[model samples]
Target: MILAELTIFPTSEGVSVSRYVKEAVKALEETGLKCESGAMSTTIEAPDLKSIFDAVERAHEAIVKMGAKRIHIDLHVDHRLD
Candidate 1:
């Protein structure tokens, strides 16, 4: 099992980027993974690293498509064999 914490936002969007954050959360949810949104970051659970990466990519793309030139992504992952 893989548990990841994703904090993604656009630096170029200036302050108050709730719109971009919404799109990122939407993208993550659309990946069909287990996602929980927090005040600071989002938690996602997946079966493998590939799924986590794919979800992150989707979220990044969503922010990019929203006209964000500079984006920041902070991802923390924990992979447990048990």
Candidate 2:
């Protein structure tokens, strides 16, 4: 399993933060990733790196559709488990 911590900075818009977060969460879900928590930020759990990449790509697409001119995403993957 892989744990991904993502921080997304989307271009300024009039849309509500909740809406953006919802869209991001939905996109991740479509990639078969579990959205562990989502508010101003989101955390997702995936079975592998491919799923995580898929989720990230989907999230960027959603942000762009929402009128975001630019988006900065930081992802940290934890591959080792005790």
Candidate 3:
């Protein structure tokens, strides 16, 4: 499994952070990846690296589409489940 931690600072386009988070989660869900867990705080879950990457890309795109001036993303992976 993989874990992606993202920090997004979107422009003040009247779009709440929660909205971006929801869109991000929806995009991840559309990828058909298993989201074991997630949160609006700063973390998301995916079953594999590919899915995690895809999710990040989708999130970036979504923010851009929403007219975000800038966005930042950070990702972390943990392969050893022990």
Per TM-score, the best of the predicted structures is 1
lDDT of 2 at 16: 49
| True lDDT of residue 81, candidate 1 | 96
- Could you tell which candidate, 1 or 2, scores higher by lDDT? 1
CA RMSD per model (angstroms): 0.5, 2.2, 3.1
lDDT of 1 by residue, 1-82 (tens): 9999999999997899999999999999999999999999999999999999999999999999999999999999999997
Give lDDT tens digits, candidate 3, residues 20-69.
Answer: 66676666567766554345434656766777777778867887787777
lDDT of every predicted structure (CA atoms):
0.98, 0.76, 0.65
TM-score, per-candidate, Cα-based: 0.98, 0.78, 0.65
- A best-first ranking of the candidates according to their TM-score comes to 1, 2, 3
lDDT of 3 at 7: 57
Off by over 4 Å in 2: 14-16
| Candidate 3 lDDT score at position 26 | 67
Deviation from native of the Cα of residue 1 in model 1, angstroms: 0.6
TM-score of 3: 0.65
Checking candidate 3 for backbone clashes, the offending pairs are none
